[model samples]
Target chain A: MTAPSAVGISRTTRPLAPPRRTRRGSRLRYTLTVLAFLLPSALPLLAFTIYPMIGAFWTSLHSWNLIGVMEWVGLENYTTLLTDDATRRVFANTLYYVVGYLPLVYIGGLALALALNSLIPARNLLRGIYFLPVVTSWIVVALVWRWLLNPSVGVVNAMLGGLGIDGPGWWTDPYWAMPSIILASAWKDLGFVMIILLAGLQAIPTDVQEAAMIDGAGRFRRLLNITLPLLSPSTFFVVVISLINGFQVFDQVYAMTGGGPAGSSTVVVQQIYDLTFRYSSAGEASALSWLLFLLVLAVTVIQLIGQRRWVTYA
Target chain B: MPERIRRILLTAVVALGALVMFFPFAWTVSTSLSPGVGLDATPQLIPDDPTLAAYRELFANTPFARVIANSLGLAITTTALQLTTSSLAGYAFSRLAFPGRGLVFGLYLATMMIPIQVLIVPLFVQMRSLGLVDTYLGVLLPGVASAFGVFLLRQAMNSVPRELDEAATIDGAGHFRIFARLVLPLVGPALASLAVFAFMSSWNGFLWPLIILRSEHLQTLPLALAGLQGQYTTQWDVMMAGSVVSVLPMLALYLFAQKYVIQGVAGTGLK
Candidate 1:
């Protein structure tokens, strides 16, 4: 992609300058060239990403709605959101979603990936099948799951009735709504995690496994000792991505429950959306969004710190 | 004898797992074909009397066709622009020895780490100010210069040898000529993979489109599908039919290019 003559241009341009040392001149030219390459991307990043983030932090300090005159609250928004009962409940619900979602997706995805990695004849087809939902939009998946999990005319309840067992109102009932969202999210996400794990499995050298086999190691022993250790990097990637995605769980919850059934499934993102767009409480929404940002930042830093011990890349 | 039995059991287990993984899709197809009330009773494995009424209803009542068209247009346009911009920037980063290169690239990748939610408000405000809100350009603008695309393409471009550029230059090719004639053709596979990822992401995108596209005619498939669910009120057969329409193209693309897609994602070291 690089033109060999471009370096010649740099040399010729430098020679055209005064015979004295042109180190400072070349540095200036280099800086301009870098800016030319970065300007398009940097413009958006500044306008959309960084500026808004700082603006959110600033807005969170005040109490302002869409039309009201700005009233400087001085941390009242944060303090109120931190201590309010509804805010506490919403935070608790978000925790419920994370706790419910992470393990199911992580362990379930790992098991599926492992199972598919075994000596299955149609492994490619199976992998494709498992990964199908990953590429589909979550809205479609959520809609379909809502139908299947419907209490009265749904297939799940129908099957339950056939088995002489009663199925609860999956989306309507308070207790089951969050679990239903978790199951739907897991179904949509499992394929992505499995694909990552399968790639990790394929990267594991065959000689390592063969040597273990020659030493009379059984299937389970080799899996425990050799395979698992080599797969840690991919596992770590899956965990990090899944956790970030789980915490940002908005689309499915929005479509499936709308944070209804008495706000049982009201995740932090939904709260932010409701506050900003629905209620026009931009200040509070900004506060809540900043809170989520900090939480995610803290988690990501912890993961990066933790990665030193586990993640191996060549 | 025990080993032989164990092998058979393993086969059974794998088959069962595959079956369960595929069950929801299969059930969706079956339920779409089945007559009304068939989906509610005992969840029949096979439809007793199949009909195309749901498909008919889907086409007749809603703007399903328009939604499909909008999604295709958005996905294709966004992917094309993304590939062009990212390829240019990626080539520059990999081949050009500009100053502040490290800091610039770092800033680009840093944008990837920030959750897109943090940017929504300003982006919306910016779009509103530009009078681009509720337009196709609005959906396509933010994604055209994607950081992940730049990152992936740069990785691929770095592997391309410098000799190719020198040969083209010696043959009297200019910089743009070398880029188009020599560089781009060599990185065809990488470009194709990036295109696939971009297309899938744009096609499956819901949140941005939902927030931006207010007009009914411009609504994408996912948005349209969500609307169908509410308007129909327990008409799943029709909803499933709409979903099938939405998903079929993606399925076809994925099946045909499964190898490239897998290689592309794996190439990113995302695994």
Candidate 2:
């Protein structure tokens, strides 16, 4: 955009400023150039993301399906979502999922990162092996897990049977369903979390570790004092990103259980999907989306506020 | 504990960890290859009666071939469109100094925080209004403008030397020429990484396409696979075969370009 302004400069200093008209013209050209580059992204995003965002908020206020006359129902959708038992179950299930999933991911990711950072052979191969699941589609992953965890003929049950133990129905059991999905999710995302944390770990200066060692610091003491503190930024990144993603958890749950076992596994996004597309309740769906969005935003804001305590850049 | 024992223990743990991570994928591949194995039977990791029967069954049962084609075409188009817009926007944000630049860039970044699921209802509603539902464009349009890609490439373009663009300008080349000839080539690796990510994301995208694409033939691989899963619930081998068919290309692509993909995410976190 500023390319045209190159014409305005002179090293000789033989003349004063260029014509005000030409200067203004270059600015105009620069503005046009900027817009020209931006339009391709801006136009589609405005149409698809931005416009729909405002539309979602507006639609949340009205009982509108894709067809028929729209009826205004201010706050009713929100009120019902808050008050309804079914929606409450969905909300609580989402909470349980976040509660169950995040800790596993953080602990598992940190453990993997620490282990790999300390010592392991064939590092890239191990990293690839760990990362394999992240590449596979959630549909495939869910189906595979469903087959693995089936009560009657599943491999997991067969192994339990070998030990003279009765295995619970994983996805079909109301109590274990969310936990099972959480486990699968934890497995699916472990690689990404590990990679991020490992990157953070590797970036630590070895001299710091050696300095602690020379000072007769125990391995545990060094890790607690130095490694963990320095690793917090990556940990913070993984936690926030995964938590936001956790709120939107749908693909695996939908593909595996369809939020079944009497809605024990329904997350917020799945509820939104069912409400909008299946039941043609666009207003309710929009309300649920906004609710989910607010939840994610809140969690992100909290994390951002919390990060300064431990997430040291240096 | 001595260093040697510690190393061995760590190695064993890592091996076990990798096994835990990879076992599901191996099971899927094994099951897909070992057709007609019942869930009740003790599953064999390597079947005695290995066959392509499940694949044949998958092909016979669904228009999976067409589904794959639909997915391939949609993913490519989406990637191409995203790369174009992202690179252009990245160039502009990085190189050009214009009024309201920070505001515009901030707006774009804000949209990234809003989950794609949150936009599904209204986005679909908008598409339905425009009669884009059930069309390729309907599915493709929603994924085209990527905030991550723009931000990543902006960082990349910032790393690129401004001297090249200035030199080109001194030779009477315009901004477009500088962008096209000088800036874009320098950011080639970043674009490559962006392409891989965009392709992976569009390929794995389920929610929007499931809502938009109505026809069985128009459905992408994920949607089609979900449909097949609903139909053939207990037919593990057949479903796994279909999963394999859907997953193989991505697996190949990922293994081929693992460094770039990992680097992309790491670079973002570092920034």
Candidate 3:
């Protein structure tokens, strides 16, 4: 009887162990299925994004024209870019654009968002109207702005003249070239900023606003105290995105001014393109790109750290 | 200010701002329609002698039509590829249980911060080495795999009920079948939102195309438009006409799918 019972237990345990093995096999099958699903994106991302990123850094270390053999010159490209006055000016120009663009676009967006958030007739229509530029390509906007700000034949100065004010040579003037870029950039991006801020505004509970109202908080005071503090996340987003984009400003510069008027408006990206394609200095271009990558990464990290002091999650 | 007065004042200001914002577009259309070449001192809101001469000249003389077709074809292909890749990866990340999923998804997210400017040099080298320079595939391939699309779709897919997938699994449905038949239909809005973004980004893409496609016939709209401006700096009407042609399709798409576009943008920041 004891032998028979032991045999019965062994038989039951054998079936259970095999089932466990089957479960393990199924897990392996699941992983294979997952790989199949991810293959389309993973292959491209590895080939395009991941590999290129590493390749960029590697290429930065080597001096090579697109056509010629790569010569390993460790850190030489980076050193040249650092000491080069023209490259220095390009980075400064990019920073200047960010400094000018961030505030104008953010403020303009905040204004529009606040207005749209209010009770207004044709709200969507008004929002869409303001957002017209956001949908158009930079080239189209840049072209329009070139004509609109044409020193002689453009409508902008023409209108300014009608208002008893003389408008300066916009894209032509070295002093105004970056400002001109900022203006067009701000114009195009305001709608995007507005949409972000509007979403932020709407997320704030009305009860919070009403509570402030019941506490006798004035409209301006509520906005400054209650609204803005709560809206910091979106504001931060607008700033960070605007900064990153401002650094990469190219299409407008390419189409509108071509980084012209003595290279006053030449930014990092324009320099990168010219260095590679125009000048056939791929190593320097890669080096410059990595520098920009560092700049953007540093700024974004700073913003993220700084947000902890001001951004209220709730 | 009184409530009524404040409301009226706000309305007036908002309306004025809207007009200011819309003025450039109105001016572009008017300039394109105007008969003469350069702009006048004061822009004509409505051109006195409105004609389609610039449009006619643009389509007839230049490769504008071919450029448009190239742009349209490339954008469609890019968008389609992006959707397929993104949705599949999104389903894997959100629904499928697999080892190392978190790490892989983290990689996907991290790539979003790496701007294209950083990668362009190496990418161009890769394309050249592959002998894909001046090809449509060169312009189309790099943009087809979008990290943001995957992230967005994953977010959308996550909200889908797990019970549905489990029930399908119990009913002997495979992951692919469940993904296509069940999860996908539920995430239609996200797919649309991603589609709009993909299309817009591809259509507006300039830098890669500018670098990759050296041939005149291969030029996308933005590249061709930039070239048009370079060649005909004084031809405001034709430039504006090219501008109009470049901008109209996007505007029409935006108007038709305004909600999806706005949702895509708004969703991004909040995320």
Candidate 4:
């Protein structure tokens, strides 16, 4: 950010520089060199991201069981998946997880950011401790939480017992299974959200808050009027990222519950996995993925537009 | 209400929250060390009689050693490939002014928004067609290029002084020589950050490896650990041991390069 503008200023001021486009031989050499630099990455990205994206859509229109040749059954997969009761339930489950996850994570993240931003001893160590989960793999985290939330002999229930209350059967109970996953997910992401929000917090000018303080603004009022408004862009960033990730919550659910206890915690990506690998319904899986993509794109676009109303840029 | 009193209160609150974050990890280590067949009815922050029995069983009873080797090998390869590809492309985008550069770069960035789930089925098919399924190549091929890494490095490379490149050009150094000798050294920190991110993501990757790697001998640490959790449903000690082993490398990496990891994550969000 600092370099490009400085270079622009220097270019305008210094007039004796040689023009870049004049030499035919050098231009050809430059083009070849750029191609050489680009092709290594460009090839894999094309084969994986670009080609498979188009191929995913094309496969969604056909029926294949991964062993046989793809049979053309255009739109049938989409039509069936769209109307299936199980599909609706799984999509609804994903939404439920996102609804619970997004707010919990953001609020927790913001709270942590605010506390860490204040005058505190060992702030750096505290920040690293909170971020520990973010660096750990989802499988490990889910496994640990599964043990932690085990209904029979888990620490959480024991802690509750000490408090004279009974802890619910977390991942084991069908009713509480999704909530259990939400808790684990939110716990893992709090540090990520904290780091982003802390960066935003530090970016806010101190003079603004001091100015408010001189004007007799209390702590809460300054937080509302001066701080949060300046922090909106980071807040928007965390929300959009958390929302996109929430829609694709799989590893934890897979490891924790396996969408279990009557498929209560079954999510969209898990459904995609089940449809493709378990059921051998590759076409439906591809169709379901497309549906997920559309949902993410729609939600992200809406958030982008909505940010204009609430997100303050300074 | 007093300044010192308020500071103490704030410190206490933050410390409590930090404990909540760190407790799971502390318990995992404690449980792994505890000598028992399964979990106790009550939680124990410290085991009464700790032993290395679980870790011993984790290695003896399972293919954990092989799993770690597989994960380490794949992550190292993935990180190396990502650094080469992303740095080369990033330098080109930042320095060389080619036709349709903006459009191509924009396409790369757009691809970043599409989650990997969308490409899984077709990518599996493509790999199977190439006769590479259940092989290491299949697991590593799709992830060799990263759009996020490219963007991060481009931002880093963009900040390098152009006047240095101009002087190098005047001295008749070609683009490759200048890229190798001049620009790359200046962007070492960004490259380190990219390396860290690439290694961590590959180390933690589950879905692709689950689908592609089928053999017991070829599974990554996460895949094997999940398999262990399923195969030994009641063995909490063993499971915790596996979790600890899988997490230790990442813990070490984060501690060793703490700045790059945090900076890389924060840099992406802020930008």
lDDT winner among the candidates?
4
Residue A29, candidate 3: how far off, in angstroms?
3.4
TM, every model: 0.91, 0.95, 0.95, 0.96
Q: Cα deviation of B16 in candidate 4 (Å)?
A: 1.0
Per-residue lDDT over B110-167 for candidate 4, one digit per residue giving the tens place of the 0 to 100 score: 9898899888999999999999999999999999999999999999999998899889
Q: Any residue pairs clashing in model 2, and if so which?
A: none
Docking class of 3: medium
lDDT of 3 by residue, B1-271 (tens): 5998988899999999889888898889999998675844555778787899999999999999899999999989999999999999998888754445689899999999888889999999999899899999888878878999999999999999878876887797877898999999999999999998999999998888998999999899999999997788688999999999999999888998899888888888887
Model 4 residue A252 distance off true place after TM-score fit, in angstroms: 0.3
lDDT of 2: 0.85
Model 1, range B1-271, lDDT digits (tens) per residue? Answer: 9977876787777678778777778878877887574344534668878899999888889888888999999999988878887877887777665445679789888778777665555466568878998999888877877888888888887788878877766686655676678777888888888888899989988778877789999999988988986898767788888878898998888888888787775555452
lDDT of 1 by residue, A1-314 (tens): 22123444457444212123346665455446555655666665576677767777777777777456768888888888998887888878888988988898888878878877777678788878878887788888888898789888787888888899999999999999999999888888887788788788888999989999999999899988898888888888877777777777788988899898999899888888788778887788888888887888789889989998877664
Which of the two, 1 or 3, has more lDDT? 3
Comparing only chain B with the true structure, the TM-scores of all models are: 0.94, 0.97, 0.97, 0.97
Identify the runs in model 3 with alpha carbons over 4 angstroms from their true place: A1-28, B39-43
Q: Can you write out model 3's per-residue Cα lDDT over A17-68, one digit (the tens) per residue?
A: 1112335566466556767889899999889999999999999999998887
Candidate 2 per-residue lDDT, tens place, A1-314, comes to 24334343333221211223456666676667778999999998898888899999999998987677889999999998988887888888988998999999889988888887775679889888888788888888888888888888777888899999999999999988998899889888888888888899889899999999999999899999999988878878888888888888899999888998888898888889989878899999999899888888998999899888778888
> Distance from true position, residue A48, model 2, in Å?
0.9
For candidate 4, what is the recovered fraction of reference interface contacts?
0.75
Badly placed stretches (over 4 Å) of model 2 are A1-27
What docking tier does model 4 reach? medium
